[model samples]
Target: MHAPGIWGIIVVAIVVILLFGRGKIAGLMGEVASGIKSFQKGMRDEENKPAAQIDASTTVEPVAQPEKKDA
Candidate 1:
């Protein structure tokens, strides 16, 4: 009663797909998969990089040094 069953969800999905047509849905899924693969590849390449390289790339220096105040 509280939760909708799986069959009801599947029926709704089928109706939406029928309205949108299969080709459009397939193309969208292909793009999504390509994006995910590229993201994963980037992550793996980062992981495989040397620690020194990562540290150097992410280093930030202070833009302005404060003057010492007179005692």
Candidate 2:
């Protein structure tokens, strides 16, 4: 069997709207939009910041350990 046509999709949407009122649907859409905006802002902020810059002055020297003797 094939998938439902336009009418079937419309009927399902109507049922969904009836189950969850317009306000609920609108709130969900708003949340989705805010999340998108937040994601975009984070991406923009990251681009402005330098990537993994290391300072040469602060050097970490390796600790020398005494040679181990076999018992």
Candidate 3:
């Protein structure tokens, strides 16, 4: 029945909470949220930066090659 599935989920959740404790769970969630926010901010900053500016001085100059001598 649907009730059994719900109960099973509830039991699993309770077991997980008991194993980790409330404070640990909250701290983990807080850290996850902070990470997500930082990632979003980085993405926004990247979008706001001009693409040309990002790679403005990234040209690779060709290097001179020396002739190889056979032994």
- Candidate that would win on lDDT: 2
Better by lDDT, candidate 3 or 2: 2
Tell me the RMSD of model 2 versus the true structure.
4.1
All candidates in order of lDDT, best leading:
2, 3, 1
Candidate 2 residues 8-65, lDDT tens each?
A: 9999999999999999999999999999999999999999988898999999999999
lDDT of 1: 0.91
Which 10-residue span in candidate 1 carries the lowest summed lDDT?
50-59
TM-score winner between 2 and 3, please give it: 2
lDDT for each residue of candidate 1 in 1-71, tens digit (9 for 90 to 100): 58879999999999989998999999999999999999999999999997764556677887997999999
lDDT (10s digit) by residue, model 3, range 1-71: 44568889999999999999999999999999999999999999999997664576788899999999999
Point out where model 1 deviates above 4 Å. Answer: 52-71
Each model's TM-score?
A: 0.57, 0.71, 0.66
TM-score of 2: 0.71
Q: Quantify all predictions' global Cα lDDT against the true fold.
A: 0.91, 0.98, 0.93
Best TM-score among the predictions, by candidate number:
2
Count of steric clashes across candidates, in order: 0, 0, 0
State each model's C-alpha RMSD to the native. Answer: 5.9, 4.1, 6.4
lDDT measured at residue 10 in model 1 versus the true structure, 0 to 100: 98
